[model samples]
Target: MVVQDRRGGGTVAVAMACGTGLAVGLLTSGCSPDGAAADDQEPAGRAAPAAAEVRDSADALVRAGSAAVRTSMETASGGTRVAIRGTGGYDFATSTGRLRVVLPDPAGRPSGGHQPITEILAPGALFMKNRGAGVPADKWVRVATASLADGNLVTGGATDPLAAAELLRGAREVTYQGEEWLDGVRVRHYRGTTDIGAAAAAASPRTAPALAAAGDGFTTGEVPFDAYLDEAGRLRKVRQWFRFANGAPKGASVTSTTELSGFGTKVAVQLPDERDIYAGKIASPTP
Candidate 1:
């Protein structure tokens, strides 16, 4: 297995450990509510129709064909916090995308500015370049998505754009949180908790395995999320909260946010050949 050396004071390592299926320290946190009022609640106290619409957000993306994506992942542990951000585009029809992820320098360490890592996100596999710590900068590291506990959701530093929307397939207890203006576009906001197991069972065939892996990887089954959808029911923005054990008495918290825009944009991604992938042992990052 190739372990990409992640910078940022061990934050990435801790997050990746949760996906390794290893018995490491655990991190735990409460699922607190975010204050938001429903502009229009369901009639007779029944489930809102918006709930059903939220479940189909992923399908809406597939119809859109492609879009630009921005991702932000923040992990908090032991009084330290680190963030990873990425920008890219995804071709939903082909289930492939590419991102340039920027990693921060380790906290309190001398700054020798780090390079952005290029990541290729495809079905059941993740390819990364500029994987530091002795690996050739030109070589890509390939990791099977099914082999990951978190299904490469948190491990790759940024969650796969389409996978993030597919997660809504299991959305429950959904409440319409009114409409808001985002990036000059009007969007309806919804809040809810999604069951990973349920999502795995309902997700598209190509995405089921990854969600299944995540259902078994994380300590908690319920993931709370806030989603913003356009009038056309396309996913405009989403924020999901996750907790994983990191070998700590009290585990850490991770907040992953993904933003989508420029629907129907052109996204071209090329996969690396087998020979270009690194085959040697990957040196782990120093603590």
Candidate 2:
């Protein structure tokens, strides 16, 4: 697996042989929700509609078929911060998507000279291009999602858009915050905490393994999130917070955000042929 140096000046190709250690390196190196109802206010003491709507957010997207997505993942440690941003489209029905992710600069800013990494997301797998370091630019590197400690959630830099919505299924406590306009669309805002274990149990089979891995990998199974849903109960935006053991006593903190739009968009994602995948060993990054 290839990861950007903490300074963002170069890339490090960590051998897959390192196994879970690679996941820790990715987290320590700073490499790393749903919507609600319509009414402006829910009557006091009334059940928050989001409690139920959030769980169905993924189903709503499946019904929509596809949508364009924008994702941002920010990690902070020892006063240094970096972010990974991505843009592309997802086919919810097929559980596949593609994104071009841009790594941060030495200053942890998105305005960097680093080339964008193209990522192809599929059930139980991830394919990346321009992975840097020893990998050929034209050859894709594939990794199994179930093998990663974080289940490719933070390891891929940008969280899978669909996985982001599915996490909401575990919402244990949710409060509808009210309605707000997001990109000219009225959406209901909700805040809650989700249980990773619960989400994995409730997730579709295609996503269950990854979510299950996340439950075991993160320092805690509880995740805090904010979600925005449109009138149709479609997820418009979500932000989630995660923490993992990054070799630090207190661990590391990551904030992941996903925004959705252009519903019903036509998205064509083609996986690379076996011949196009890189089969050679990856060299380790220099000290």
User: In candidate 1, how many Å is residue 118 off?
Assistant: 0.4
The TM-scores, one per candidate, come to 0.86, 0.85
Model 1 misplaced stretches (Cα beyond 4 Å): 1-48, 77-80, 107-112
Clashing pairs in 2: none
What tens-digit string does per-residue lDDT give for candidate 2 at 31-64? Answer: 3322342335454674546578888898998999
**Residue pairs with clashing backbones, model 1:** 25-246, 25-247, 25-248, 26-245, 26-246, 26-247, 27-245, 27-251, 27-252, 28-251
RMSD per model, one decimal: 4.5, 4.9
Which residue runs does candidate 2 get wrong by more than 4 Å?
1-48, 78-80, 285-287
User: Once model 1 is optimally superposed onto the true structure by TM-score, how far is the C-alpha of residue 268 displaced, in angstroms?
Assistant: 0.5
How many clashing pairs per prediction, in order?
10, 0
Q: What lDDT score goes with residue 137 in model 2?
A: 85
